[model samples]
Target: MNKIQQQKSENISFNYFSLLSLMFVKKYNIQINQKNEKNILSFYS
Candidate 1:
């Protein structure tokens, strides 16, 4: 329950969520070589 432990937990959560998001994008047949410029732009838009 210390500050350092809390920071580490937050970092691990972020890494896990990021990995899950990437897997989701691929699972739905999303292309990764579209320069990611318009891809992300349209994705979040």
Candidate 2:
């Protein structure tokens, strides 16, 4: 009973952590893409 509750809480926390990391990764990717675009434009110029 108590163990089950603890397990549930752990699962919830793990899920939340993954969601936060996913958002962080998406933001990082967008930044990288913007940098790449700037590099490409500079190269053409």
Candidate 3:
């Protein structure tokens, strides 16, 4: 029983970390895209 509970908690923590990392990656991608757009605009100007 204790082992089962431990496994469940570990799974939950792993899922939480996965979600956090996904969000971080998405935010990073958005920032990079915005930076690229600014560079392009500056080049045109």
Candidate 4:
């Protein structure tokens, strides 16, 4: 209700969003790397 509380809430939400974004990015990176590997293998074959 107060300014301090509102700021705290905003900080928590921001942290949650950042953590989710980081996890999503990590998963995406893994998928991209796997796809690259597959492509390289196919190209060689």
- The estimated TM-scores of all candidates read 0.55, 0.69, 0.69, 0.67
lDDT against true structure, model 4: 0.91
The per-residue C-alpha lDDT of model 3 at residue 25 equals 99
1-45 per-residue lDDT for model 1 (tens digits): 699999999999999999999899886645564556687888788
Off by over 4 Å in 1: 30-45
Model 3 pairs in collision: none
Q: Report per-prediction Cα RMSD to one decimal.
A: 6.9, 5.3, 5.7, 5.7
As for candidate 1, its clashing pairs are none
Quick one: best TM-score, which candidate? 2
- The C-alpha local distance difference test score for the whole of candidate 3 amounts to 0.92
Q: What RMSD value applies to candidate 4?
A: 5.7
Better of 3 and 4 by lDDT: 3
lDDT, residue 16, model 2? 100
lDDT per residue for candidate 2 within 1-45, as digits (tens), equals: 999999999999999999999999999977887879988678779
Q: Please give the ranking of all candidate structures by TM-score, highest first, separated by commas.
A: 2, 3, 4, 1
Q: Write the per-residue lDDT of candidate 3 for residues 1-45, one digit (tens) a residue.
A: 999999999999999999999999999977887879987678779
TM for candidate 3 is 0.69
- CA error at residue 14 for candidate 2, angstroms: 0.8
